[model samples]
Target: MKLISWNVNGLRAVLKKDFMTIFNELDADWFCLQETKMQAGQVELDLPGYHQYFNYAERKGYSGTAIFTKHEPLNVTYGMGVPEHDTEGRIITLEYPNFYLMTVYTPNSGGELKRLDYRQQWDKDFLAYTNQLAAKKPLVYCGDLNVAHQEIDLKNDKTNHHNAGFTDEERADFTKQLDSGFIDTFRNLYPDTVTYSWWSYRFHARANNAGWRIDYFVSSRDFKPYIQDAKILTDIMGSDHCPVELVTKDLI
Candidate 1:
């Protein structure tokens, strides 16, 4: 199975910038997106041979996520079942016979760490939700988790240490979650490799390759053996972020 995850930043904006063109090229079994920033009917998508599922934030033009899959899932869920956290429409889960596939746009802590407390709560809740699901089935979750997770996951780590996504609290939350038996697909595939998915629009970050690997394809530990490859599609251009991909040999 081939899965591709991208933080499109803005679906409508990327649509004008050849989003469909790249989408067609991927031809993945499952394609996921984060930071979609739109509600239903805001944009029209014609993805042939794919089932489209979208979760929109209550506050329009903000956080959202989507998934386009070739196969229909047994069940689909929109949130983590936490009322306080469900308003942003940041999560979407599709339950297949063998595993649960989820895409999440984790809350950003904001420029001055204003939302850090709430973000921390979210991190805790999200991990619990995933663990609950894992108790029933293997999981394949992907999206812009919004944290660098480690110093090696970003460029200029020293300078970005205090930044929103690189804050100590956020990083610790990620570490704790991973310790609970999930694998960062890319890192597990290439332990020391350095690559990034999200880049700042400032300081010519993309041009200089000053970026952060905030997006991820993470799975339950038991599911890792099936993953054949993990990739960061840095060359594709449209949004400030690029697509990350995972290829798994058939295990079903």
Candidate 2:
């Protein structure tokens, strides 16, 4: 099976762009999105043969996530069971017979590290949640995690070291997540090959290839063997983030 994840930034806005064009071109078995920024009934998507699950933030037009899958899940859950974290609609988990697929939009540690504390709590809780699910079944989780985990993950590493996504606290949490038995699929496949999924809208970043690899498709250790390959579709564009993908056989 083929799976793709992209942070459309805003689903409604991307609809006017070539979103559908790329969607059709990729033709993935599962397509996930982050930062959808819309409430229920705000938009209607006609995706034939795919089941769509969306999680909307209580604060409209804020953080959100959605997943479109050809394979129906045995169960679908909207959050991590924590009221504070669930309020943002940042996560969606789909449980299958043999695996659980999750898409998440991790909270950003805003400018000046204003939300770093909350983000830390989120990381801890989110990691615990995935680990709990992994204990039951192999798992594949992806989306805009909003952290440049390593110096090699961004172009201006030294300059942006302390930035929102590059702060030590944030990067450390990411490391802890991996240490807990999850594999960063793309990095694992292309160890030293540097590629990025997100770019700043300012200073002609994308054109100059000055960006950060903050988006990912991570899987539990048990699911590692099924991961055939991971890709960063940097060429396809609709939002600031390009799509990242994972290919595999029947997960069961």
Candidate 3:
């Protein structure tokens, strides 16, 4: 099965930018989206083949997530058991017979490290949530995780060391999570691929090939054997972020 994740930045804006066409081109079995930034009835999608599940932030036009799947899941869950985290609509899990598909829009630490503390807390909670789910079955955790993870994951590690996504603390948290039993699927498949997903809109970052590998499709260690391939659709347009995809040989 092919599972794709993309941080659309803003669903309404990207829709106007022809996200539907890109979605069609992907033709994935399951698609997860982050930073939807809209509420129910606020936007309409004409995707006929997919079953859409949305988790909107309580605050209008803020952080949010959604999942569009061609195959209906056995069950779907929203949030990470913390009311504080739930309010942001950052996580959504779809449970299939074989594995759990979790999409997360991890909180950004913000400029000047304003929300660093909160972001650390979010990392802790998110890891715990994934661990609990892994106890039941294998997992596919994919989305804009908001961390560069390693120096090679970003274009300019030296300059971005203190940045929100590249901070030592943030990278360490990501490392710890991976050490806990998840594999960064793309990096594992294309170990030498320096491709990235999200890029700054400023200074012609995308045009200059300046970007960060913040988005990911991380699989539980148990799912490693089934991972066929992992890809980043950098050529696709519509959002500042591109789509990250994972293809598994078998669902189980």
Candidate 4:
């Protein structure tokens, strides 16, 4: 099975770019998206042979996520059942017979760390939610988690030490999540790889290759065997973020 996750920044915007061409080329069994930034009825897609699911934020043109999959899930759920956190429409979980697949767009710690406290709470709650699913079956969750994780995950680690995605608090929270029996698929596969999934649109960041590996495919430790390979498709262009992939053996 091929699973692809991308932070499109904005689905409508990218659709105007090379999204359809790139999406067709990847041809994943499961394609998950983050930061869709639109509500229902705003746009319609023409993806053949895929079941689509979306969680739209209460606020229009804000944070949102979507999943398009070849296989129909046994069940589909939106949000984590946390009222405060559910407003942003950041998470969607699709339950199959053998495993659960989730897509999340974790909240960003806003300018000057204004939203840091909220983001920390989100991390804790999000981890708890994943734990609940993993207890029932193995889980594969992906999206822009909004953290650089470690020095190697970002290009300007020293200068970005206190930035939103690179802050110590955010990184520690991600570490806590990983410690709870989950594997960061790409890093687990290529420990020394320095490729990044997200680059700022400022200062010619992409051209300079100054980026952060913020997007990811994470799975339960016991599910590791199914993950044949993980990749950061840096060459793909459209959004400020590139798509990340996980190639897996059949689960069903």
Candidate 5:
């Protein structure tokens, strides 16, 4: 089935910018959204044949995520079962008969690394959560993870080396996540492809194609061979980020 993930930046804002048009065009079996930036009741969406699930931050107009799926899940979970991490509404896991699908909006380390420590802790906790889930069944995890894993991921490696998303510590954390046996579907499928989902809103970064490949569709090792395709839909626009998509048959 087709699955797509996009960090809409702000769901409410994107809604006014033809979000529905793209949604209709893509026609994905499942659409996962990150950084929705709105609390409950802030926006109303009409998706005729999809079942919707949303996790909103307690703070209004802040970090949030939602999933729209044509196939209903057997069970759905919000957060990582950790209060500190759950409060941000950064994750949602949907359990099906065969696997678990998780949509995540990883926290940024902040411009000056002010939140680096918390971000590190979050990485550890999220990895642990994924591991536990993997132990139960195969998994497909996707979203804007907010980290550039290597020099090849961003345009100016030397200049961005010390930035929050490209810091040694953050990259190492991402490496650790992959080392734990999850496959980064996109990178694995197109080893030489070098596009990105997110770019700086300032500096006309997206227009210039100066960006980092921070979004992903990572799956458990056992399911890697089933990954039919992984892509970065750079042509689409609504938020600072474009969409990243993945395909596999019988997602359940």
Candidate 6:
């Protein structure tokens, strides 16, 4: 099975930028998206063979997530069941007979760390949610987690030490998540490699290749054998973020 996760930044915007062509070329068994930034009825997609699921934020044109898959899931759920956190439409979980697949758009710690406290709480709650699913069966979750997990995860680690995504608190929370029972697939596969999934649109960041590996494919540690490979598709162009991939052995 093949899966792709990307933060399109805005689905409506990308649709006009050859998104269909790029989507067709990747041809993943499962394609998950974050930061769709739109509500229902705003746009319709023409993905011929996929079952689509979308979770739209309560506010229009804000945080949202989606999943398009070739295989239909046994069950589908939106949000984490916490009203406060669910309001943003940040999560979508698709349950199959053997595993659960989730896509999340974690909240960002805003300017001056104003939202840091809430983001920390989110990390804790999100981990608990994933832990529950993993206890039942294997779990594969992906999307823009909004954290550059380590010094190696961003190009200017020292310079960005206090920045939203690179802050120590955010990094430690990610470490806690991985320590709990999950594996960061790409880093687990290529620990020494330096690649990034997200870049700032300002300052010619992409042109200079100054980026952060904020997006990811994470799975239950025991499910590691199913993951054949993980990749950061840096060459792909459309959003400030590129798509990340996970190739797996057939689970069904």
Question: lDDT per residue, candidate 4, 136-181, as tens digits?
Answer: 9999999999999889999999999999999989999999999999
Clashes of each: 0, 0, 0, 0, 1, 0
For model 5, residues 1-252, the per-residue Cα lDDT tens digits are 899999999999999899999999999988999999998887778899999999999988999999999999999999999998999899999998888999999999997899999999999999999999999999899999999897778988899887889999999999999999898998898888788888888899999999889999999898776689988999998899999999887665
- What are the lDDT figures for the candidates, one per model? 0.92, 0.94, 0.92, 0.95, 0.92, 0.95
Residue 129 lDDT, candidate 1, scale 0-100:
98
Candidate 6, residues 59-134: lDDT per residue as tens digits? 9999999999999999999999888799998999999998999999999999999999999999989989999999
lDDT of 1 at 160: 83
Model 6: CA > 4 A from native: none
TM-score of each: 0.98, 0.99, 0.98, 0.99, 0.98, 0.99
lDDT of 3 by residue, 1-252 (tens): 899999999999999898888889889898999999999899878889899999999999999999999888899999999987899999999998988998999999998999999999989988899999988999989999999988889899999998999999999999888899999999888888898998999999999989999999998899898898899999988899999999888673
> What are the C-alpha RMSDs, in order, of all predicted structures?
0.9, 0.7, 1.0, 0.7, 0.8, 0.7
For model 4, the stretches where C-alpha displacement exceeds 4 angstroms are: none
Question: Candidate 3, residue 187: CA error in Å?
Answer: 0.9
What residue pairs clash in candidate 3, if any at all?
A: none
Tens digits of per-residue lDDT for model 1, 1-252? 789999998999999999988998888999999999998998888888999999999998998999999999999999999999999989999998888999999999997999999999999999999999998989989999999988889998998888899999999999988999899999988989999998999999999999999989999998877889999999999999999999998734
Candidate 4 residue pairs in backbone clash: none
> In model 5, what lDDT does residue 65 have?
94
Question: Candidate 1, clashing residue pairs?
Answer: none
Candidate 5 residue-wise lDDT at 193:
78
Candidate 1's TM-score: 0.98
